[model samples]
Target chain A: MANSVTAAKATRGINKTIIYIVCIGLAVLSILPFWIMFVNATRSTAEIQSGLSLLPSTHLKTNWDVLTSKSFDPLKGFLNSFIISASSTALSVYFSALTAYGLVVYNWKWRQAFFTFILCVMLIPTQASAIGFYKFMYQLHLNNSFLPLILPAIAAPAMVFFMRQYLLSTLSLEIVEASRIDGSGEFATFNRIILPLMTPALATQAIFAFVASWNNLFMPLILLTDKSKYTLPIMVSLLRGDIYKTEFGSIYMGLALTALPLFVIYFLLSRYIIAGVALGGVKE
Target chain B: MRRKGTINYAKYGYIFSIPFVLVFLVFALYPTLYTAFIGFTDMKGVIPKPVHILDNPFQNFKELIFDNASFRQSLSNTFILWITNFIPQIALALLLTAWFTNQRLNIKGQGMFKVLLYMPNIITASTIAVLFSTLFAFPMGPVNSLFDALGWSDAPIQFLQQKNTARGIVSFIQFWMWYGNTMIILIAGVMGINPALFEAAAIDGASGFQTFFRVTLPSLRTIMLFTLITSMVGGLQMFDIPQLFITPAGGPDNATLTTSVFIYGQAFKGAYMYNKAAAASMIMFVIAAALAALMFYLMRDRSEGQLRKKLRAQKKAAKAAARGM
Candidate 1:
């Protein structure tokens, strides 16, 4: 019995070691591409073409200069992306919360029906309406404008669904009643009392919305034809197509720049993002 | 005083709901209907023109379904790519989730591992696509140079030029980017299972594998179904990577031409066939709606419905017995 127990313990240790090795191996694989991209960004086109180096080189300044001199402007792209993502995220989160609050608070007729309608809306993929939306925007003279891109976010059904689910579990009616009793207007109560209560959900949804909007290539690619108004993804895409001007270092630099903000955001709020995904899965 | 006390506050709900409702009507609902309408009309070009309803209402749809080789190839390619990526993705995700969630293994630094794994997903897909394209650049790329140095090949491989390899790389990228996300969701599902179930399985002399199969997998049915349907829906809309990975878009021979890419090409690219694109979009929308409906049907509480049926039957039987007595 004693011999068998020792053998079992030894086997257990072996299994744990194997598991750790596999986990670490995958983690490395996950990060290897990004590492190569960053490393390549620092090396010149010739060095990058010659071979792969795991180490960062001294050509970062040169690459940045090369990148800036090209039609692809990282700073402008970043500014454009920031403007779109920030405005859309703000609209998506705030309005979603308000809509969810509306669904939850008042014992109104058509509440359940409206919630179901929103849920149905969630099932429709955005790509399905791309052509018509493009045409409609063109007809309205809203194409090439940020208003069409940002305004549609106000009706983000998935965000509304998430917010509604969050409110259903966390919101208490007594607070709304209390605010009402104290003569606070409905909108004021929502802005003051309710928005604070939804800070956690709002933050999680805001991050998701921001990332999504930032990474959105389809709409902007179709809508914005002007080079000056191009977002980061579009700039990266432009770099891909410019084979004659293939400065590998500068191109990699552009890709890295496009991904840098996301990396920073992910690193800072990974805990919340992961938790949000997990929660989203469970709720689904 | 009674009237003041009886003030109806329901209007507040409508007031708050108006913004969302109006936005949805203008943006979501109207666009969808307009797309459907466009599918039936002959609207094409960069400049706006009066759209004429097709003589046969199904002219674009019939032509696309029957005649258009490119659209059909795109449809098949989309499925092929999605399946190739999804199979490996779910397999790796399940394996990782099993390892991570195993109580016996009790993996350390799971948080750090998860963070690293999910890192790729947060980056822009366009950037990721371009990064991979550069990494696998022909003749003098890092991949080619590495192969040359290692004596793996006599000549540099034209990765993007070849159809199969290009599709494979695209599939690999998709798998790499998403497997971690799937694993995270699966881990959450596993965590949600009651510990008592595992304890009971252990008491029954079940091994770790047996416990996972019996307790974990059984309990994860709902979440797994959710994952599967959502992944399917998302897969149907796959666009960015395939679009930006190669020049002239859609890689060599259009091997990576997804349905979305096809739609994009129709409306935005050569010839600007807005009506045809709308028709394709409508088809995709219909398929997606069907899948969602199927998911809802599968996810319904069948056991509860059965239990209610049984209760009603029992009530009828009890009443009949009383009447007989």
Candidate 2:
């Protein structure tokens, strides 16, 4: 009986290990595209088309040069992406955090109604109004500018929801009461005391908003038409082809350039991504 | 927070909320209401647009939902596509979550794995579409090379050129993008469970499978429903991948045309069909609203029932304890 039990335990251990390996191996397949993208970026397009090269190649600089040259205007595109994403992030975090703070901490008329409005739009995917929004922008005569892209981030409902979660964990009504006793105005207290307390949470949501705005393609695609105003990815795609199909190396180089910000951001702030995603999904 | 000496609290409160109201009015509320208003007109996409009277969108709505065969076909295809995409997304997320929770996975860097999987999400869709374009290009891509190595096929296959193939690959990409998100949520949900209950199950000689079935799934009922419903709402809006796949040609044989894409194509991409586009968008909005309502209704019912059961169990246990005392 002892022998049989011991054998069963060993078998179970082996099976658990196998399951773990298999599951994580499947997860690796999830990131395979990024790996492939990196590989393609490093090699010459000819070498890429020919076969998979396991290691980084020396041709990266030439590819980098073409990508960064005046024709690409890589800096301008990066600057454009940066300006849009940063503005969106600042607007989204400020507005959403304020609304979230009001909803959670204050006693306001229609608070329940306001909350219901927030909840209703929570899961309504962007697709529902995507076309409508595009046409609306066209008529508003704002389609050509970045305002159409950056303005919407201010009312980002998800950011509001995320802020609510963060504030719930970090803030207390007592703190507000104390601030009030100290003769601090509500906004002043919120801006100074609450904002300081909420910094970590703010960072998380800000990163999320930044990444989201940075990655926004469909809206920008349908809204912005001019080549001069294109974000990095948009500019890159235009480089590869809009009038004519170009060389694969330039396009691959363009892809590498476009994807670089996200890669760097990911490496720098990976911890917050998990928290932001989980916070949104937690309640539901 | 308005205590006896708190200085000018109301003024500050109002000040902080201005940016939010400004943005909401300019962006979300304005566009949404304007879209619905436009739906009432027969206006197409350009200036001096054809208006067929505001009161009657019946014809346009009818064309979008039932009368036009292509619209109807895309609708059916979208339904099929949503189900196919969501199945693998939810399934893989659940499996990954369970593995992450398992003591034996012994994974050295679990958080790193999650972050890596989620990396694709940050890249622009154009970049993703472009990456996929190269990865599966005819005669030259690595996927074809792998097929060649396996002797599965002698010739190259243009995966995105054909009708069903294009839809399949597009759906596959959506599934790939969403799974990492769902998996992370499920991981957090699983981690939120009471470890004591799981330990109790183990002491009773219950296997991992039994514990998951008896404890984990039930506890995660709300979250699972949430994932499923949101996926249905969002997955049906397949536009980008299909558009890029069949780009430079409005879609191969129109097989890759999504409803949003079709509406967009009409309104701007091709000849402006504003009234038709607006009508289609209205119909699309109605369907989405209905689906969202239905999910919420169902989810509320399930949770309410579960809540009742939990209350009853607690009441019974309390009574038994009182009697014993």
Query: Quick one: best DockQ, which candidate?
Result: 1
lDDT of 2 by residue, A1-284 (tens): 99999998898779778876875776677667667677667777677667665576767876777665545777778888899999988978777888888877864445546666776677665655665687777768888789988878877776777787677677888999988888887778878888888888789888877877887666777778876677776674565354324345556667778888788888888788777788667773
Which residue pairs clash within candidate 2?
B44-B274
Best-matching candidate per lDDT: 1
Runs in model 1 lying further than 4 Å from the true structure: B1-4, B301-325
Off by over 4 Å in 2: A61-72, A239-246, B1-18, B45-55, B104-108, B248-250, B298-325
Per-model DockQ:
0.78, 0.51
Alpha-carbon DockQ of candidate 2: 0.51
| Candidate 2 Cα lDDT to native | 0.73
Q: State in Å the error of residue B251, model 1.
A: 2.1
Positional deviation of residue A32's Cα in model 1 after best superposition, in angstroms: 1.0
Q: What's the chain B TM-score of candidate 2?
A: 0.82
- Report the Cα lDDT for residue B174, model 2: 79
